[model samples]
Target chain A: MTTEHGAVKTGDVVARVEDLHVHFSVSRSAPVRAVDGVSLEVRRGETLGLVGESGSGKSTTGLALLRLVDATGGRVEVGGQDVTDWSRRRVRSLRRRVSMVFQDPAASLDPRLTVGASITEPLIVHDLAASRDARRSRVAELLEMVGLRADMADRRPHEMSGGQKQRVGIARALAGEPDLIVLDEPIASLDLSVQAQIMNLLRGLQEQLGLTYLFISHDLAAVEHMSDRVAVMYLGRIVETGTPEQIYRNPAHPYTAALLSAVPTADPEAERRRRRITLHGDVPSPVNPPSGCRFRTRCPAARDNCATTDPELYEVEPGHRAACLYAVEAVEEMRAGAATTP
Target chain B: MSEPVLSIENLSVSFSSRRGVARVVDGVDWEVHPGQTLAVVGESGSGKSMTVLAATGLSPRGAKVGGTVRLRGEDLGAMSEVERRRARGRHVGFVYQDPMTSLNPVMPVGRQVTEASEEHLGLRGDDARSRAVELLDMVGIPSPEQRVDNYPHQFSGGMRQRVVIAMALANDPELLIADEATTALDVTTQAQILELVESLQERLGTAVVWITHDLGVVAGIADQVAVMYGGRILEHGTVDHIFGSPGHPYTQALLAARPQPGVRADRLATIPGAPPVPHQLPPGCAFYPRCPVRGDERCRTEEPPLTEIAPGHRVRTFYRAPHSGIERPAS
Candidate 1:
């Protein structure tokens, strides 16, 4: 699936995963099926938001693509090249095509290293810059791209604020000039006001550099704003996939609907008027997930069929799919209900 | 309105640090009536938590606490240390962000729940056990009698929070303080907890002080909101007033900065510059550096008082806030 000269044309699939699985073996216990039979496609120059709660395996799926975690089964293709079974040594070249921005920037960066060195390390490792002077200039350019001052290059991680550290992290990720970036909860640690700043910088950088993003965050509102399309993950599977409009407006899966309804809008009037669906019981242990449907234990719309049969992704509309037996009916009912509402 | 369940006046908390005196909660004043919920909203270091800590007599060691805190019309400042501690357990209850930290890991859930009842209500043995089960059942914990024996680790994150809530209500305190109680749970679980708290509040008529950084949560749960910045209350008003007709630049910027559930925009409205540190706070308005609307030079040199712009609404800024049809009365 390698493109000519590693050049992925616009609208091409920059990264694709087919039935990917990442399982960790826990001693004296059942293996944790972190990423079980997941499939996704991230297109060139588009941000695909991965929205999920904790223990949903979204981060594991992202790590699987970067070969940080080994895929126990299935295939992963990044930049049109299959890296599913690639060793750590062979995976180094793949890093040049894909990079990651972690949730905590302070943890991701070295406290001792200057911001410039942190950004330049990737360039040196990837051999993107030929000389030391070239690396220095490239580091400055990368910092400027992330809305940080060139003078910030000399500052240490502890010397900067949370937002500034995140900017440095983004600069380091951009240093590799990767075709795709997996932003795993990039703005989760920053303050509310600073979150907007980092988000805007990311969007601007994406537009300027034509970088594809796999934006992973638990914040549903943020995912809706940034993604052209969104995939809702529950337990270890992608339960729903659609454009932000379709997914947020008319969620086909019950889990998606419950998650959406749970988020209170910033407006008081709307929040008070909105109908909230409270799920009974907590999420089942991932080690021993509920039979058939993983969300059946807590789903408000669960039926006998949900407990008996494992559902697969079924198309509720063009480019919109949900892994529920009642997807088609649910979508139709929601749409009809919405149309009738005053 | 009936008498306030908890009233704080000119509450100030400062710690003597190596760098300087860090005035964390500076002259905060508010009141919460019975069955009312006041959300103290702010980012980290904004002193929302410090204000609550000082009011509850839980301020850290070597910290100076000034002003009066009245619980159920009794002044806390005048009470002795032992009296204040006893009053805190009987009149006020707390639930923090992490349930693990609040609950005793080694103790049975029922034992932890019964401790408050035993100490505050003088319920002993069977009476305490029955009360524990009853409280747990009220919090929607299924099979309360059986689950009461379980330890904190046995229950899930959401269920643990439920147990914590049950314990908080064990003493039947008139005031409850939940500081980011549901922030750690999943959205579905958070919804369940929020519903549980709301229902409990309704049934028990407990006034609640909800301290959080999430504006959306504030909109859903709060009757009144106090926006804090750099250890000062920039704005205090009803939820409608704060969200619909903000009278402070900081409040307006925060409302605009947050990404609403349904609205999608190319770029979010942002407040430039970082929030101020407590020690280095400027003498003028705390939000002046990041405020989008700075009216005049006076705002940079003098701290404006919290002046009422409307009945039950106040803004601490020299800039004339756009009040629409309602005119600001001269202060």
Candidate 2:
């Protein structure tokens, strides 16, 4: 259940989820398995990118770490402390160690509050600042840290651009000085030009503060760029996990390969010659997912065994693992093919 | 050369509000011939969508449209409302970003697909249903005969999009306008939709005007690329020309900004500022504020005209071309 690969010596674990599950009960039917048996680790000062489509439970897993949603099963540990059984009042104190930045900055930030007030609220809530002047000074520092002008504190959310609003959201998140920050699709709404600015800012912040991030997004390219390690989620399960180089270069899982193949490159020449592995149909409903393998219904390499036996995270390399029965075979064949090619 | 399927000449669209008159699409000109896919790439408020909307006579209320839009060499502006509607029904098809909004939840998917055919092709009852089944099958829907009766809610997002695409193709329009059609779907689903559209275009020879902010999608599916900013096309050329040697700095910056899946960079290149607001646009180039390689005084004072640098490739810039070191000033 721990899913700690033997050779993954990536420093101390800042945050982790072991066999976590979150279910939402509907009226007359079974509960929706939003996050079913997902286990992951965020190493100290390193980013772990979670990539998936809508309803893949990537968000739910992140929420479980923050205790925003109650876990139905398994354990969630933050800073090496198991907090899965913690109550709401107890979880309030946990805010100092773990925080979240949501996707829509417009929706997250209050319209009535100034940028300074919004960031200051966190400082006051956590009792990080003693006086009003201290809170103001801290707010200014946070603003400058996120590449925004200190004068921006006086402005409201509507006065700022999408990228600027997101920066404020980041500033608010950093006010608590948390060890782990869950960035849920932080740059999805920004323009192409602005997205890069935010991504660079996040990377710089992570390095300067030695922070750990559980970056969740549907954008594969952004994930590969920002993350030290990548995890592919499918139907509320972590299907594969590896370093970006290992996963992007040579993926073991059929779902991972298909996802990678589907992302079109910016270079037209490369795109023209590329062979895409298109998956058929759509992601299965989470209410009643496929019996054995969640992805077998749409996977190209799925066989008879895939439909009967639930696959575990099979080791493909020292630090790379995939939840597919034939992943080991696929990885070996891929390496062989690579060796034979020029 | 064959005649263009759709053509717009110096088209400008403006909306007057309490604040001021904002020119959303300013003197834009583009032509899409049969079997050609022209991608209009830009960020929000870049007017890529407005250009097509105004050209197709589908601009929102209170919009003041100027210049000429021709469909199959016939002037759309000169036509009456009914005539324009008839022309649009017969010639143009659209697919928006969200399939759910495009489709009605209560109606059967078959009736929706058959609506266009019945209205335009004069098909009735059994004939219309049969045509809907064919369209669904063509769009790669399995068991199209049975799935045709399913409502929009019954199908998944990807399948619902397929149904919408089938609806768009019901009339076999000569021109297809897909505005961010794959933006809402996942990458895998997006790939499937892109492939379906490509294959359908090959068989039907329908011209496509794909409007999206994603340069990667543009690079993959486009024959021609037009990079729009501040309601004006900063760069326009064939995909090879645009991707290989982007003449404009904005185009260059956008390409650098995207994080390529396989390629790793220490830090992604960033554009300094936000996009220009339409009503408060600068006196000079719209991108002048954020232009990393702006030229002397002229680039900050005078707007650059669209100048032809090579055959079929035009760029609007005052400075020398990016990477080429060739000075092709606005003329």
Candidate 3:
């Protein structure tokens, strides 16, 4: 490691995961490793984007952090305190400091409850505000903070548009004054114009409140636009971790490179000129992921060693790391080679 | 080109809701030539889905459909419900957004495919089952014989989509309407699906009308692109023409809105506000409120018709006229 840990140490760490593993019983002899042996940290006032394909353990890792799902093995530390084996009462207390925004806002919000009630329920549950007047004032403030009219809060979830509902969900997550929020594909369901609005809202709120976010998504472009740092996940493991610029411009892992290329470019001329690194085969079952590097099956640079020995995440550049032996060597080779062609 | 495999002219679809009479699709004109992909690109509720749904006579009850839809020179507007139903499966295939909903959850994958084949082609028993397996194999589903018996829930998302494709191709219709087919899939699976659609179109010579909001999906696959905004075709032209020399401000804004990978632009050029609803559309240009180049007073009062900008490219915008101050690039 390059010891850029010093830079990360300067900031207050809001959430940290140590060797988290979440497994589900698939059959009598098999267990699906939804999230296996993952370790990460989210700093206060920072956005950590979790990028991955479906069945890649990205969502499971987010859920594990919130204790929404049972963790098979792991230590979840929020605000420098370990809540790994907390009592039910302690867990409820910890939830006040942390909140989560689900993928589909329409599905997440209670259809029967009005938007105002849905948002204020968290405040009531956490006992953050005692009086009805206090709760109502807080709800109105949250709605205004998320760029929604306070008057519309009386409407039910079905009455509002998709973007409006998502804003309400964000308002609900913010009600508890959380230090960290887990956003799982928050803007995936919204249209492009609405997605931009949500992204801007989230960015503005982060700056204003100094809140941390564990942003999970499959869209690389959106991830790059929002996150300060990103961790690429595959088969329940963090395959690569780097800043947004590093991940997009100089991808160290083959899977990351392929994923970056897979996102379609808006510039037609550039789109035609760029060569996409199309991967073969579908994502393998989490129950029986391939040995060693789980992405080796679809990795274009996979070698014989990739099948036997699992690569440890090593720093290819300052603060940029990848779990691929070949990636490190490839980076060295590219460094040695001259600027021969465009 | 020869007569289009599917031609829709002046098509208007209206629905009587409790609110009022909502004109979802208004005076739309579109065509699909054999082996060509015509992409109908628009945001949700822009009438893209309703327009196509009306074309196959599959609109919901009480939906009023007008204008002429000619498939192989036969008028679909004049056809009876029963005749339209028979013509739909035999001559036109439809692929919905959610394959899980389109495919039966209880029925086996093979049986579902065979049902479409048997219903449209009258193949029965062993022949239908054999054709179903062949269709599965054609769609690149592995182990067609054993995997065919698996239920919809048993298959993965991509595999389930493949099964849906097989069912769509069972009748081998001349025209295929894929409404947001790859929207639910991931990037890699989406690329595969697009490639499959392209290769199959080449082999079968079937014209495809792909409806989606994702510009990337239409980038390489579509031969012709029709940009719809506020229930109107704002721009229609060859893919290269639209991508390189867009005429309408709405189309330009859409192109600028999408963020490209590896390109770190400071801010995305966004057209603020959502598309207006069918009943609440503004006078003249429905996009005037969000149009970046809205200047002339006529744009606020006079509705522009689809005027030819090039040999093939057409745009419905008063801002792109001869002396409208917006210079047209040499075609």
Candidate 4:
């Protein structure tokens, strides 16, 4: 697990999940297998980006990591402690180790509370501050740390813009000084420029505080940029995991290739020449996912083998793995074919 | 080139409030030719939507709309309310971002679309129904005859959007206005929608005004691009010129801020402040406060007129800084 700057050591795992599953029984219908048998790890001081489209269980996985959603089956170990089925008392201790920045800042923060109150709420919950003054000053310090002015702390969430409310959300997430932070689509709804601001802030904070992040989003471009390691999820399963270069430059999975090609770039000439792999259908429902390989229905290179036997994640390169039979050769062929298409 | 399908001269939209009048779309001018797609790119509240709404007489009541909107040389501004509505329905079509809200939940998808065809195209009952099905099939909805009777909720997000596109194209107007139509869908689904629109435009020869904040989508389909900020277009150019050598600093920053798939940066090129509020926009250049390369007092004291910087490329700025990457800090 050698990284660019050697900031993340190979074995220093901050959080780990083993064969996790989260099922929901909605409207008395069949159980929805939102997160089905997924497992991954977040190394200390490195961001692991979880990306997928809607109903792919990326958000559910993020919630399960902090025990906000009960684990139907499997174990979640954070900071070397099993927290899968932690009691209320045990979960409180887990909260001190793990905090989350929700997708919608407006809904996450209490509308009635001031920004200062919201930022200090976590500190007071875990009793991290010795005194009210200590908590107050820490709130101010956090505001400054997230590049917000101290005076804005007195304003409520409605008084600020979306970007400012997100800043408050980050300040609150940092109040506990957790070892790991789970950011669930933090910039999905923000504008392009504001999204850039938040991404820059997240990167800077991770570097400065040595904090590990499990950044989850459907935005593939953002996930690629922010993640030290990228995990592509499809219908509640991790289809591929690798470094940005491996995932973006030489994607092993057909799904990853389709996603990369789907994202239209800012260069017009390149777009004109780009041969898009147009996936013809919507994401199949997770309740009744495809029988064998989940993406077999949409996978262009799917075969008879894909329908009966589920392929586990296989290593294609150092620190890179994909759960597809044609990941190695077909993807290379497709890449070469695309480059010379026009 | 053939006559422009839609042209607006000095178009502006303002709403009166207790505080004062909030001018959202301020003195905007643009033209969309038949069979060409013009992308209006902007952040939220940048008046991209308002410009189209006002030009097509869809803005909210009590809002003040100024300037002339001419579609096919017909003065839409001088038309009476009923005449304006008829002209808009017959000549212009609209598709919004969220298909669920724009579509009727209780109405069957078939009926919802045929209503537009019946009202605008004047096709009778059987004619409207069959035309609706054909339009749905054209938008790539499978088994359109069977699925036409299903409610909007029965359809998936992408299919619902396809239905919306069907509704937009049922009348086969000369112009189609899609405001953030594909922004809500997944990347793959967005690609499908973009391709669908491109093919439809090719077949029907309808002009398109695509309003979105995603430059990637702009690069993919737009013939010309307009970058909007603070309810005004800051830059306008052909897609090649805009992507190749963006003439404005804001345009440059917007391009730099996009997180490319293979590109990694420790810090994204940040534009420091949020877009100026409509009511509180600065007197001169609306983007001056957040501009990386500051223009002199001329930019501060007076608004810069749109100046042609290249063939078919215009920039609204006094500063002629190099179109370098968005690394220089916001002034």
By lDDT, who's the top model here? 2
In order, the candidates keep a fraction of the true contacts of: 0.79, 0.85, 0.35, 0.90
lDDT by residue (A136-174, candidate 4, tens digit) is 889999999999999887999998989999989999989
**Model 2 stretches with alpha carbons more than 4 Å out:** A7-11, A331-342, B324-331
The residue-by-residue lDDT of candidate 2 on B38-86, one tens digit each, is: 9999999999999999999999999999999999999999999999999
Docking class of 3: acceptable
The superposed Cα distance between candidate 4 and the true structure at residue A63, in angstroms, equals: 0.2
Candidate 3 residue lDDT tens string, B1-331: 7889889999998888788878888899989999999999998888999889888888888989898999888998788878888888888877877899888899889999878668778899888888888998998888898888899998878888888988888899899999999888888887777778878999999999999988877777788999887788999998877787888888887776666555556567677777788877788887888888886788888888999989889999988522221122455
Off by over 4 Å in 4: A1-11, A333-342, B324-331
User: What are the TM-scores, per candidate, against the unseen true structure?
Assistant: 0.95, 0.96, 0.92, 0.96
Off by over 4 Å in 3: A1-7, A26-29, A328-342, B294-301, B320-331
Count backbone clashes in candidate 2: 0
Candidate 4: docking tier: medium
Arranged by DockQ, best first: 4, 2, 1, 3
**Tens digits of per-residue lDDT for model 1, A243-295:** 89999988889888878878987788877777776667877778888889888
Estimate, for each residue in B87-185, the C-alpha lDDT of model 1 and write its tens digit: 999888899999999999999999899898788779998888888889889999999999989999999999999999988888889999999998888
